[model samples]
Target: MAKIRITQVKSGIDRPERQKLTLKALGLNKMHATKEVEATPQILGMVRKVEHLVTVVEVK
Candidate 1:
C-alpha cells in the first residue's frame, strides 16, 4: 500500500468540534504536526473536511 503525508498547517483552536475530531481521526495533533497514512476513501473524506487546516503530500 502507498502512504500519504498529512501536515497540519493551521490551528484548530476555533474550528468546529467535527473538524477537530476529523483532525484527530487523521492522526494529527497540534500545529505543524504531521502523520503518514494510507491513501483511502476515509482519509480523503477527512482531508476534504479540514482541507484549510492541512496540506497533503504523496509518499511512497
Candidate 2:
C-alpha cells in the first residue's frame, strides 16, 4: 500500500465535533502536525471529511 502524509494546516477550533474528532483520529490535534498514514479507503474517507482542515501529500 502506498503511504501519504497528512498535515493539520488549520485549527480545529470553532469546528464541528465530528471534524475535531476526525483530526484526532488522524493523529492531528495541533497546527502543522503531520502524520504519515496508509492510503486506504477508510483513511481517505476520513481525510476527505476534514479536507478543509488539512493538507495531503504523497509520501515517497
Candidate 3:
C-alpha cells in the first residue's frame, strides 16, 4: 500500500470533541506534528473528516 504524510496544521482548540479525538487517533497531539501512515481506507476516511485541520502529502 502507498503511504502519506499527515500534518496537523491547525489548532484543535475550540473544535468539537469528535475532531479532537480524530486528531489523537491519527497520532497528532501538537501543532505541526506529522505522522507517516499507510493510505488505508480507514485513515483516508478520518482525514476526510478533519480535512480542514490537516494537510496531506503523498509519500514517495
Candidate 4:
C-alpha cells in the first residue's frame, strides 16, 4: 500500500473544531508535527478537511 507524509505546516489555533479534529485524526495534532499514513481514502478525506492547516507530500 502507498503512503503519504503529512506535516503540520501551520497552526490551527483559530481554525474550526472540525479542522482541528481532522488534523488530530491524521496524527498531526501540533504545529510542525509530522506523520506518515497509508494513502487510503479515509485518510485522504481527513487531510482534505484540514488542508489549510497542513502540508502533504507523497511518500514513494
Candidate 5:
C-alpha cells in the first residue's frame, strides 16, 4: 500500500468532540505533529473527517 503523511496544522480546540477524537485516532496530539500512515480506505475516511484540521502529503 502507498503511504501518506498527515500533519496536524491547526488546533482542535473549540472543535467538536468527534473531530478531536479523530485527531487523536490519527496519532496527532499537538500542532505541527506529523504521522506517516498507510493510505487505506478506513484511514482515508478518518482523514476526510478532519481534513480541515490537517494537511495530507503523499509519500513517494
Candidate 6:
C-alpha cells in the first residue's frame, strides 16, 4: 500500500464532534501534528471528512 502524510493544520476547536473524532482517528491531536499512514480507502474516507482541517501529502 502507498503511504501518505496527514498534518493537522487548523484548530479543531468549535468543530463538530464527528470531525474532531475523525482527526483523532487520523492520529492528529494538536495543531501542526503529523502522522504518516497507509493510503487505504478507510483512511482516505476519514481524511475527506476532515479535509478542511488538515493537509495531506503523498509519501514518495
- TM-score for every candidate vs. truth? 0.92, 0.97, 0.99, 0.91, 0.98, 0.98
Q: Pick the candidate with the highest lDDT.
A: 3
What is the model-wide C-alpha lDDT for candidate 4? 0.86
- The C-alpha lDDT values of all candidates are 0.92, 0.96, 0.99, 0.86, 0.98, 0.96
Instruction: Count clashing residue pairs per candidate.
Output: 0, 0, 0, 0, 0, 0
Off by over 4 Å in 5: none
What is the per-residue lDDT of model 5 for residues 1-60, given as tens digits with 9 covering 90 to 100?
Answer: 999999999999999999999999999999999999999999999999999999999999
**Residues 1-60, candidate 2, lDDT per residue (tens digit)?**
999999999999999999999999999988999999999999999999999999999998
| Position 17, candidate 4: lDDT | 89
Ranked by lDDT, the better of candidates 3 and 5 is 3
lDDT score at residue 12, model 6, on the 0-100 scale: 98
The residue pairs in collision within model 3 are: none
Clashing pairs in 2: none
Q: 27, model 6: CA deviation in Å?
A: 0.6
Task: Residues 1-60, candidate 6: write the lDDT tens digits.
Answer: 999999999999999999999999899999999999999999999999999999999999
- Of 3 and 4, the candidate ahead on lDDT is 3
lDDT of 1 by residue, 1-60 (tens): 678999999998898999999998888988999998998888988999999999999996
Worst 10 residues of 6 by lDDT: 19-28
Give the per-residue lDDT of model 4 (tens digit) for 1-60. 899999999998888888877777777777899998899999988888888778899999
Candidate 5 lDDT score relative to the true structure:
0.98
**lDDT of model 3 at residue 5?**
100
If ranked by TM-score, best first, what sequence of candidates would result?
3, 5, 6, 2, 1, 4
